[model samples]
Each structure stands twice: as C-alpha cells, then as structure tokens.
Target: MLKMMTFFQGLPGQQSLLGTLDPGLSEAESEASMSEASSEDLIPPLEAGVTPDGEQEGTSKKKKSKGLANMLSVFIKGKKKKDQPRSSETEVKSKARPELEGPPPTVEELKAALERGRLEAARPVLALERELEAAAAAGGTSDEELVRLQSKVEALYVLLRDQVLGVLRRPLDAAPERLRQALAVVAEQELEDRRAAAGTRAAALVDTLWRGGVEEVAAERLGARPAGVPAGLSEAESRFLHMGRTMKADLEAVVERLKPLFPAEFNVVHTYAQSYHQLFAAHLDTLAQFELCERDTYLLLLWVQNLYPNDILNSPKLAQELQGIRLGSLLPPKQIKLLEATFLSNEVANVKLLMNRALELESQRWAQDVAPQRLNGYCHCELAIDIIQIISQGQTKAENITSDMGMQIKQLLLVELASMLRSYQHIFDEFLEKSKLLKNYRANIIANINNCLSFRTSMEQQWQIPQDSPSHLMDPLKELKAHGFDTLLQSLFLDLKLLFKKFTQTRWAAPVETLEEIIATVGSRLPEFSELQNCFREELMEAVHLHLVKEYIIRLCKRRLVLKTAEQQQQLAKHIEANAEAIQSFCTQNGSTATWLHPALPTLAEIIRLQDPSAIKIEVATYATWYPDFSKGHVNAILAIKGNLSNSDVKSIRNILDINTGVQEASRSLFSLIKVV
Candidate 1:
C-alpha cells in the first residue's frame, strides 16, 4: 500500500494531497492508492502549452499548473472513496473506444490505405496510377520519388495487361468481375492515350493488350515449326494446314467467348479478326517467298483463296456473329494474284507432263505387243482415264480457288487435253495400221472409242463445253471417235460390200440368199455389241444399220437389172420387203434404238412395187415425208430400179419428193451417209 503511495507521489500535485489525506498511513500506501486509480481518466495536456483553439494562452509553467490543479482535484475526490471494480465488458470498451475516437490520420497513412485497396483489388488499379500521375505533375515530387512511383505504376499496368490477356486467352476460366475491371482499366487508359497524342503507338494500352492476346493465342494454337508432319506433307504444308485449322478454332473462341465480355465500342470480334488476318497474312507472305512444292503450293493457295475465306471467316457461326464486321481477305489482291499465277504455271506444266506420260505409257504397251485388257468383254485402257483424271483434278483445285479461276484452269486444261488427245489418236492410228495382231486388239480399239465418247461427255458436262464454243475441244475427240469406229468396222464394211454385190437380177429372182448371208455375218458379231458402254452401244448398232441400208441402196441404185414387167416388179418388191424385215430385225435386236431408220427400206419397197404412175407418186411422197433427209439423187437412184417408169413419170415422182422444204432442222440424215452413181 505504501509502495502504491510512492507511485502516486510522482503525479503533479498528488504528493501534498496524498500526505494530507492519510498521515497515519505510510506515504507509500497513499501513493499506491493513487497509483491504482485509472490514468485514462486524466485530462490530456495541451501540446507545447497551446490551448484547444491553438492560442498560446500562457507559458509552459502556467499550463503545467492548470493541469496539476485539475489532477489534484480529481485525485482528492477519488481518494475520498475506494476504487470501484470494473466489468470485463466495460474494460474492453474503455480500452477500444479511445483508438476509435483518435486524432486525424497522416498523409502517408492515407497513401498506404489506397495502395492496400489497389493491391487487394478493392479499387481500380488504374485510378491509383492516374492519381500518381497527377501528383507527379503537380510539382515538388523529387525525381527519385517520381521514378519510384512510375516504376510502381508500370508494374501495375503490366499486371493489368496480363489479366486482360488472360481473360482473352482463357475467357472461360476468367471471372466476370476480373474481366470487367480489366476492361475498365483498358478503357480508361485508352481515353488518356487518345487525349495525349494524334498518332503515337508507343505505350498504347489497347494495342499492347489486344495484340498480345491475339499473338499468344496464335502462337499457342498454330504451334512451333511442325517437326514431324503427317505422311506426304512437307513441313510448309503441315504448318499451313495447322495454322488454318487452329486460327479458325481460336478466332471462333474469341467470337463466342471473349467478344460478348467486351463492350461494342471495343469491337472485339472485328479487332480479333483483323489481328488474325494480318498475322496469317504475314506468315503466308514469308512462305510465299520460298519455292514451295506442288502439294504445299496448292495447300497455301487453298488456305488463302478458299478455306480462309469460305470455311473460316465466312463460316456459318462466325459470319452470323460478325454481321457488321468486315474482316476482308486473308491476302491482298496483288499477293493472291501472284500465288494464282504460280499455281497456274505449275498446273499447266504438270498437266502437260501427265498427258505426255499417259501417251508414252500407252505407246509402250503398243510397242511391246501388250494386248489391251478386257473388262467384261469390253476393251479397256488406262491412258484416257488417267489423263482425264489428272486434268480434271487440276481444274477442280483451280475451281476451289475461285469460279473464274476454275474457268481459266479449265481452258488451260482443255487445250492441254485436246493436244494430248490428238497425240493419243495419232498413236492409236499408228498402232492400228501397223499392229499385226489387229484381231486380238479389236476389243481394245472399241474400248478406246468409248473413251473418246467419255472425254467428249466430260468436256461438255463437267467442263461446261458449249456445243458451238470456239475451243472446239469436241473436234479432236470426235475425230478419235470416228477413227476408232472406222478402223474397227473396216473389215465388216468390206464384207457388206461383197454381199451387196450379189443383189444383181438373178439374186432378187431367187430366195434373196445375199440378204441371208449379210444377216448371218452381222448376227454373229451382234453379241460383241453388248461389250460397249450402254450409251455408245446403241450408237454402234445405228452405225451398222445405216451402213447396211446405204450399201443395199447403193447396190439397187446401180440399176443392174430393171424390173420391166409388173410381175417382175412385184417379185422384186417382195424380195426388198423381206430384206428390209431381216435388216431392221437385226439392228433392233442388236441394241439400235434408231427405229426411225427401220422404215427406210420398207418405204422404198412400197414405191417400187406400185404399178400406176400416180399411185407411185403418192407412195414416193409418203416416203420422202418419212426420210426428209433423202435427196433428189437418192430418188433418181430408186426410179432407176423401176424400169417401166417413163421420163415424164419419173419427173413427176421426183417433183413430189423435195429434199429441202419442210425438213426439220434437227432431222437425222441417213441418205447423207450413202452415195449413188
């Protein structure tokens, strides 16, 4: 107790008060009583003897006396009663309340609070940066201090850039709040950047953030130089293919994921599109410098001109999303033209080489006495099929570039194909004429005829060759068709010539043995007609039919023995009718759909068997209507067979049969293939 009295004696004015209050108690006990009293209850002294209003009311001695009088009064009163016990709750409040009501904070403390807000992401980091910039500009900040602040600001911006890019590069994982904060910072920096300069790119946040994001995505997806590419692909080919596929996928991600996160003013889709387009163009520009292989060249052209535009930029999802955005071409027109020119040059050279190679291989087979392979009884050769496919593929690839380019490629290939086919025909002609084993190669020649027909069809249908087009790609193919048929049928034609020679007066009076011989000869070979492709089989049968009709007509037109009597005319007409029946039956059975040619011989027999000159004239008129293509020369030839007709009668009959008038322009001419003396 006395020791506590000694502690109280140290307080101002407390020594005299404590001595007076307890003379019997020791001074130490009195001091201990005062010491136990709460120090927080004491009034705070004025700083440096200044009053609350900041006036120097008195000297330090006067302020200390005033504080001691207040402390002595409080201590005398407190010593009058024992100290009261405090509750735990009241003790905690007493300890905590003073700090809560403490004096105003310092400037450094305010700064520390702002920094904490920024670091903790509670405040916009860019706002703190802008405040720093404003402070530095306000003056009195030392260069060292400014540099330190600038470094800190730079670190914050860098972190901001990373966050923005992270949002772009991994949008699905980024938080919406973090993304909004990043965009707000970018927008704020953008406004500041625009206000500062007209055309400065240095330290531009928008470019830095957007371009960094796009480049990171491109590099990651496009991948480093492809090491082990797929089979048959060169390094460049593999790189371009990978680049195209990945760029498309990443841009789609940007459009679908990142674009909606940013505001419309940011133009996220267009911005990413342009960045990818420019980057891909740059890559292609580098590649175009080198001499790429054919595969790589085609692949590059495909990406630039076809896949990039059609499959990537204009893909259904991207196109719909980027309705107002105009991301333009992957490469500029001038560069694309250069690529096209290169591709065309390569294709032209390749087509010519392939055509020559096909011709050479075929010629080798001929030289080696290798019989052409037979497929299902039809002769087959790979030359025409191989050559056509090569040209077709080239044209198809060119078409993939563009429709106009496709036409250009087709024209080039058509010329090449025409030239090659001409050479092929020459080779075919040379082989057919010189080859000793002609019978063994007969089926092969027929197959080649079918090949020429296929070539013509492809040129017309696939390449869109017009009937009257100046290219005349059809001319050589037609010649090839004619040449093949002419060579194959030369022997059959010779047989027909000899049999028709038997149509003299004696054979007509007999059982028409010559007609039966002709029928047997053609019927034996009719099974071979099935070997030709269906479309051409009818054509071959028609050719045989026309040949037989023309030969028989030529024989009768010779007027070797005229039927002077009506009975003789009747007998001769019966023989002609029977002959017509046999020929028409053979042609129709052998797949000749030209039933139009079936009535020619029967109609001619009707004109011959008639006795009255007027009746004959009507019959000739009907015959001419059926065979509009029949000429006056043919009518005169038929009149020669009817020996009883006078010159006047023949003239009237000939007048009824006009060759030119009323003939449909599209009519097929059978007599045109025949000649009479």
Candidate 2:
C-alpha cells in the first residue's frame, strides 16, 4: 500500500526522496537500504506494457484472481502447519526388525485392543498380528490394511490404557467421566444384553470344583464381590453370614412379638453382656430341641463361641471397676468349665483378653438401676422348685444314700456350730484336782470356753463358707448324697433337743446335801475336806445344769412351738404319715454302758448305769482322792457320797458328783474318811 501511494503521489523518484529522508531511527534507514540492496537492486525493470498487457486483458485471469483470493484466505486461516518443515519418512531408514511370532501381538497389546473396542475390537487386532507373524517369518512384512490395523491398535492401546488405569483409581461412588458418558449412552436393551453375558460367566463359577478363570473371569466381570474378596468362602462362612443377616432381620420381628410383654428384661447395660451370652446359649439350646433341617449345630456353636469371646467379652474391656463380679457369679464351676473348655480352652490368650475385657466392663459400671426391669431371676420357674423338692424327698427315703458322707460333711461344716452349743459347762470351770496314787501329773485343770462366740461365727461364715463358696464349692446335696448328710443333720437336731431337755431339771439338784447324807450314813467324815469336795460338787452341778438346759428346755420349747403352730403341726403330721417314719428299736449299749437312758432318772441309778463295775478300784473308795488311773479314787468318793440318795432326788445328787467309775471310788472314800476323821 505504501508503494501504491508512492506511485499515485509522485513516482519512483519521489518515493526514493521519501525513503532517503532522515527517519526517527538509523535502524529504519539501514533496514530500508538492506531491502533496496536485495530484491530491488537485483531485479531489473520489466519491459513496459510487454506480455503483461495481453495477459491482463482476459476474463479468465480475473476469475483466476478471484479464485486465488479465496484460496489465499483459506490458506491463511489454516496456516498453523505451513510455517513448520516436514521430514521425509521413506528416506529415513528404520531400525532392523528380526521379529518372528506365532501371533504377533503381545498379550498386553491384545488386551488393550479388546478393552478399547470393548471386547469387539479383538478380531481385527488378532488378524493383523497373524499377518505380522507370517510376514516376519517370510522376511518381508507390509500391507496398507495391516499398517492401518497397527495404527488403530496403537491409538486404541494408548486410549484404553489411560482410561482403564483411571477407572482403577476411580472412587467406588463414582466412575470416570468417560465411563459415565458411555453408560449414559448405553440403551437399556443393550445393557440387558451385556448383563446377560456377565450372568453366564457368574453362573459358571457357581459349579462345584470351579477353578481359576471361573472366579476371575466370572466375579470381576459381573462385579459380584463388593470389593477385593473372592466370590465365595467355605460353607461355614456362608452359613454364619446368613445367620447374622437372619438374626438382624428377625430382631425387628422379635421386638414386635416381645415388645408388648417387654422382653427387654435381659437388655440392660447392667447385664447386657451376660444377657447376650445367655440368650446366645438359650437360643442355640432351644434351637437344638427343634429339627433344623437347614442348620448345623456345630456351625452355630462355632458362630456363637466366636462372637461371644472376642466381640462381646474382650471388645469392651471394663472401663470402670465394679466392687463385685457383675456376671457369672452364681454359675457353677462345671458350667464355667464347660464354657472354658468348649469355647476358649485353645485360645489361652483369650483368658487375658477376657480379663482385660472384664476390667473394661467393670469400668463401664451402670447405675444400680431398677426402673424398667426387676432384678428377680427367672429361675423361680416351676422346674427349679420341682427339682429341689425331688432332691429333698428322694434324699430322705433312700437307704442307698451314702451314709458316711453326712458325717464327713458335718465334721467339715457343722462341727464348730455343734460344739458351740453343746460343750460341757464344766469345760469352763476353774477347778484343779490332785491325784492320790500317781507320782506326777496329778492336777486336772479346766478353764471356761464360754466367751468364744466370735470363734464360732468366724468358723461358720468365713472359714466353712469361703472354703466351698460360690463356684467350685461342692453342692451341699451332691456332697450330701456322696456323704449321706441326712443322718448327720438328723442327729445334730436331736442332740440339740436333748441338750435343751437337760437344762430344766431341778429335782435332786442339791448334790451337796446328798453328799452330806451319803457321808453320814456310809462312813466317817474327814476334817477340812469340804473345800476339795466343794470343787467336785461345783463341776458336777454345772454339767448337770447345762445338759438339762440344752437337752431338755431348749429342745422341749422348740417341739412345743412346732406343735403350737397349726402349719407346723399339720406339716409334721403329714410328713410323718407320708414317711412311715423310721423308729429306732432298743439295742444293747456299746461295751458296758447304755448309750441313752430315760429322760428323767434318779442320780444313783444314772451313776450305776454309767459305771464300769469291773473297772472300779476298792482302794480308791477308801482313799477319797483323785486316782492316777483317770481318778478311780475320785470317782468312788463321789458315788459313795451320792449312793443312797432318795429316788425322787437322786439324779441331781448323783449328777452333782457326776457319777461314773471315777466318782464311785471318790464318793466311797469321802463317805468313809469323813466318818473316821
């Protein structure tokens, strides 16, 4: 356009003048000189109006100008590649190829092609690979179709690798944009067709002994497994998962059925673990009663045992310590053993797990709350009562019961209690008697054990109770049946009665007066002998009083109370009638003395009965002293003193000396010596 302005304004000479004028920049003058020195200096002017006038007169030339303008505009619009030089491919030699193949494409290439085509693209890919294999073996390989196939595969692989890897990293909640777009474009019927294909693969995996590809080819393609897990586990896992789902589903059913009655009795935080354990056991136990055709007992047990030990017990270790054991307190040792042995014996590590868990549970101690649920046990069930009664009744009638066990158990548990109430009163007396014949060890010393009640309660509640206690402690009846506790209990009650009976008698109670009478009638009296005699009298008196009080009074009162109450009387009468109560017949006493006597007896006769006449020492009767041989002399003196007391008052008088062989000699000596002195 500047050159055109120059032509209109003044011509070439004027243009040169404009060009030579001092411009704002020296670079501008030098640049203009350089441009003029090149093209303009080299090209001479064309002959004026020569071939150009003929060339320019035609219509075709105008058309050609118009076409050229359109072509120039198109070229300018798409000139991005024109500025860059292109390399000649054929002139560039490729690297040496010595490929030989059965099927040319590597597995990776084949997979990429298939995935890129979505499985349909593999046929052409595989064909091209075969051609490459053939051509390589022939030492010549080229075809436009094969080249096109290779190009398509290369492009497909690049696209497919990127897309598949991206899919692999995609979050489960969302797929890639490409996949989402593809899925959106898929017609519903076409989707059903693809699903049917996936279904066939899965169906193959369902067969037994299905192996390898059956799972991978089947599960992944079908998306059967949720994540990375295999499509199936053992039969056991299936059953467990099934039962878990069933239990969860039926929970609402159970709530619906039980909510009206509120079976939440076992649902408190206080007993939640225990209630769960029991319910687990009970559900299975009850389930065992039915014929479950589809279920396996071993499997259910495995399931429950698995869940309870770790999930229930160990998961929540006691966070708060409770003062007492919160569960399994009343459970028997054998039951606990069964649990340990069956469920946890092998999992020795689980013991600590459970202990720590118990600690955790203890930490989470709930309030001692009883708002909605009562703490009462359902063991008040009729079955419990029926069982206990059966034990009680069958226990009494069984002659086959182990008779000895009762005695052993009584010795174990009740001896201290019995001794507490039955010890001789004289056991506490401060009395000392000197022996007459023995050279040494003469004195008989006694001290009271009356204030030892503390000893008694401790012996019973603490020692005996703690020894057996809540668990491993043997069952009283099981021990009874093993030990025949029936006899021991009965004898214990009887002895109590007899002791009460003995405490009440007052007749012949004055043993001192009777001693005076026997001495006066039988023989001479000794001076200063009252003191020694008084000690013996005091001991005998106390024994007689205790025996009478406990055997007679306490027992008689107890029996009378029983008869006074209508319930007791009726119960006793009915029991006796029902039992055909066994009665002991009279039998000879052991050795030389009767084991029992009439409730009331004269002192002289009682003394005679207790004495072994063959063992009596006559010299002891004369001495009026404690004999070395268990005090035969003392025995004779007491008997001689009480021998002739009247029948009406004989027992007390006889008992005052507490007649037996020792009293017999002692009494005689007292009778004779007091007179002689």
> Top model by TM-score, which number?
1
TM-scores, each model vs. reference: 0.69, 0.21
Task: Give lDDT tens digits, candidate 2, residues 35-145.
Answer: 223211211232222243223325654444334333222221222242332121111112123343453444344454445535333333333323332222222122222
User: How would you encode candidate 1's per-residue C-alpha lDDT over 268-341 as one tens digit per residue?
Assistant: 67776776677788888778788877777787788877888888877987878666777677667887787888
Off by over 4 Å in 2: 1-123, 136-149, 156-505, 508-612, 615-677
Candidate lDDT values, in order: 0.64, 0.29
Off by over 4 Å in 1: 1-223, 255-271, 289-297, 456-461, 464-471, 505-507, 528-530, 625-637, 651-676
**Residue 376, candidate 1: how far off, in angstroms?**
3.7
Error of 1 at 94 (Å): 30
RMSD of 1: 17.3
